[model samples]
Target chain A: MQIAKVRGTVVSTHKTRSLTGTKLLLLQFMDAQGQPLPKYEVAGDLVGAGVNEWVLVSRGSAARIDDGMEHRPLDALVVGIIDTVTVENNRLYSKKDAERG
Target chain B: MQIAKVRGTVVSTHKTRSLTGTKLLLLQFMDAQGQPLPKYEVAGDLVGAGVNEWVLVSRGSAARIDDGMEHRPLDALVVGIIDTVTVENNRLYSKKDAERG
Candidate 1:
C-alpha cells in the first residue's frame, strides 16, 4: 500500500461492465512526509474518498478484494481514507489539514 | 498491473501467518519495451514465476483473489509469466529472448 492524494476524477463513457458505477479518481503518489511524487495513476475509488483526500492506494490484486469487485479488471483501488499520518512522530497529515489545504 | 522482471528474493521468517510459504520476489519495474525502470518492488509470487522472468505484477487487493489468499495482507502479487509481448507489432520480449539474455 502507498499514500496518495486524490487529484481529479475520470469520466469514461465506455468501459467494461464490471467498471459500471465505480468511481475513478486520479491520484498523485505521495511520500511518507506527505509530499507528492512525480507520479500519477488512475484508481478505482472503493472507500468514497473525495478529491484532495489523503488515501491509501492498494496496488496489485489486493485492490479488488471487496465484495463484487473480483474480476473487475481494476489495477489500483482507493481502499482507505487516511485520518492521520505521522512520520517519526511528526504529524504529516490529518483530515483537518486536507480540509484546509 | 505492470510488467516487471524478477530480480531477487525476500526471506522473511517473521511475517503474518497468511504470508507463510508465500514466495516474495524482488522486482524491477519495466517499460513496455522490456527495459528496466529505476523503480523496484517486493511482490508475492503466485504463478510460480522465477528469477529473471518477466511477470505481471498485480497491484491492490486484487492480488489476493487466488484461492486461500483472500485475507492475505499482501500489496503486490505476481499473476502471469510473459511468453511474448508484441507492442505495435514489434516483438519486445519473449521466453526465448529471456533465455538468451
Candidate 2:
C-alpha cells in the first residue's frame, strides 16, 4: 500500500459494465517526505474519502479483496483515510494541521 | 502490469517460510520510451527471467494468483519474458537485439 492524496473525482459514465457504480477518484501518491509525487492515478474510492484528504491506496489485484469488488477491473483502490503519518519519530503529516492550514 | 528489466537476483536465505523456494529478482520498470525508471523493485520470479532480460511484471495480490503462491506475501511477480515491445508500429525493444548488443 502507498499513501496518497485525493485530488478530485473522475466521473466516467461509459466504462466497463462491472465498474458502473464505483466512485473513481484522482489521486497523487505521496513520497516519504509527505510531499505529492508527479504522477497521478485513478482509484476506486472504497472508504468514501473526500477530495484533499490523505488516504491509503491498495494497488493491483489487492483492490479486489473487499466484498463485492472481486470482478471489477480496478487496479487501485482507496482503502483507508489517513489521519497522521509519523516517520523516524517525527510527525510528517497531521490531517488536523492540514485542515487548519 | 508493467514492463520491467531484471537487474539481478536477490539471494535471501532467511525469509518467510512460504517464500523459501521462490526466486527473487531485482527489477527496474521502464518508461514509455523503454528507458528504465529510477526506482527498483524486488519480485518473485514466476517465469525464468534472466538478468538484463525485459519482462512483464504482475503486481500486488495478482502475484498470488498463480498456483501455490496463494499464501506468499509477495506483492510483485515476473509473469512473462518479453520478446518485443511495439508502440505505434515502432519496435521499441527486442530481446534478440538486446542480446546482440
Candidate 3:
C-alpha cells in the first residue's frame, strides 16, 4: 500500500462493465516524507474519500479483493482514508492541519 | 500489464519462504513511445527472460495467478519476452536491433 492524495474524481461513462457504478478518484502519490511525487494514478474509490484527503491505496490485483470487485479490470483502489502519517516518530502529516490550511 | 526491459538479475538468498528458488529480475518500464522511464521494479522472472530483453510484465495479484505462485507476496512477474513493439504502424523497438546496438 502507498499513501496518496486524492486530487479529484474521474467520470467515465464508457468504461468496462465491471467498473459500472464504481467511483474513480485521481490520486497523486506521496513520498515517504509526505511530499507528492510526479506519479499519478486513477483508482477506484471504495472509501468515499474527498478531494485533498490523504488515502491509502492498494494497487494491482489486490485492489479487487474487496467485495463485488472481483474480476474487475481495476489496477488501483482507495482502501482507506488516512488520518495522519508518522515517520520515525515524527508527525509527517495530519489531516487536521491540512484541513485548517 | 506493462512493457519493461530486463536490466539484470537480483540475487537474494534471505527472503520469504514462498520466494525460495525464485529468480528475481530488475526491470525498467517503458512509456507508450518505448522510451525508458526512470522508475524501476524488481519482478519475479517466470519466463526465463534474459538481460536487455523487452518483456511484458503482469503486475499485482495477477502476477501470482501462475501455477505454484498462488498466495505469494509477489507484485510483479515477467510474463512474456517481446520481439518488437509497434506504435501507429511503426516499429518503436525491436529486440534484434537492441541486441545489435
Candidate 4:
C-alpha cells in the first residue's frame, strides 16, 4: 500500500470486463512528510487534498482485491482515510497539523 | 501511482520467473496532509520514511512496465524520488518542510 490523495475519480466506460465497477482515483503519490512527489509518465488527478489528507491507495493485483473488486482491470483504488501519523524521535503528525502547518 | 517510502526490498529467489530483478518495497500509505493512514489488511514495509520522503511507486501492469521489467509477476516498484509539492491555498510543501514540521 502507498500514501496518496484522491485527486479525482477515473471513469472508464469501455474498460476491461474485470474493471466494471471499481472506483479509480487519480492518486498523487506523497512522501512520508506529506509532500507531493514528482510525477513521471503516468497521468493522475489534482483532487482537493487541501495540502494534507493522508490517504491509502492500493495498486496492482492488490488493488484488484478491494471489496466488490475482483477479476477487474483496476490498477489503483483509494482504500482508506488517514487520521494521524506517529513517528519516532518524538515527531507526531496529523491531518489537522498538515492543514495548519 | 502513490507515495511511499522504501522501507525494505522484497527478495524472492523461488518465485515467479517474470518477477526477476524487481525491487519490492514495503510501503506505508500516508494521507494528503502527510499523516499515516490506517492499514486495512496489507503487509508492508517500515523501511524508514523518516517522517518525510516523497518517493514514487508504481503498481499493477504499470509497475511491470519499468526498465528491465517485462512479463514479470511484480506488483509494485519504486520508480522515482520526489523533489517538491506545490498545492493551492498558498500551501507550498516540500520534503524539507515535512521532515521539520
* lDDT string, candidate 2, A1-101, tens digits: 45678999889888889998999999998765567789788989767888998876667776776667788998887666666655334566777888999
RMSD of each: 10.1, 10.1, 9.9, 12.9
Give the least accurate 10-residue stretch of model 4 chain A, judged by summed lDDT. A40-49
Candidate 3 chain B lowest-lDDT run of ten: B82-91
Candidate 3 lDDT, A11-49, residue by residue in tens: 434333444687766677899988889666667788899
Off by over 4 Å in 1: A1-69, A72-101
Tens-digit per-residue lDDT, B1-101, candidate 2: 89988766544333334556877666778998999786555678988998789999887778889998776656678999999999999999999999999
- Candidate 4 — which residues are off by over 4 angstroms? A1-101, B40-52, B89-93, B97-101
DockQ of 3: 0.07
TM-score of 2: 0.54
Q: List, residue by residue over B1-101, the lDDT tens digit for candidate 3.
A: 45678999889888888888789999998764567899888988767888888776667776676666676788877666766655334566777788999
Model 4: per-residue Cα lDDT at residue B70:
50
RMSD (Cα, Å) of model 1 = 10.1
Which ten-residue region of model 1 chain B has the weakest summed lDDT?
A: B82-91
TM-score for candidate 4: 0.43
Clashing pairs in 2: none
**Residue lDDT tens for model 1, A43-77:** 77888987678899887666668887786656888
Candidate 1 lDDT tens digits, B16-40: 8878888899999886445788999
Which lDDT values do the candidates have, in the order given? 0.73, 0.76, 0.75, 0.48
Q: What's model 4's lDDT at B84?
A: 50
Best by lDDT: 2
Give the C-alpha miss distance for residue A65 in model 3, angstroms: 0.5
User: How badly does each model clash, as a count of residue pairs?
Assistant: 18, 0, 0, 21
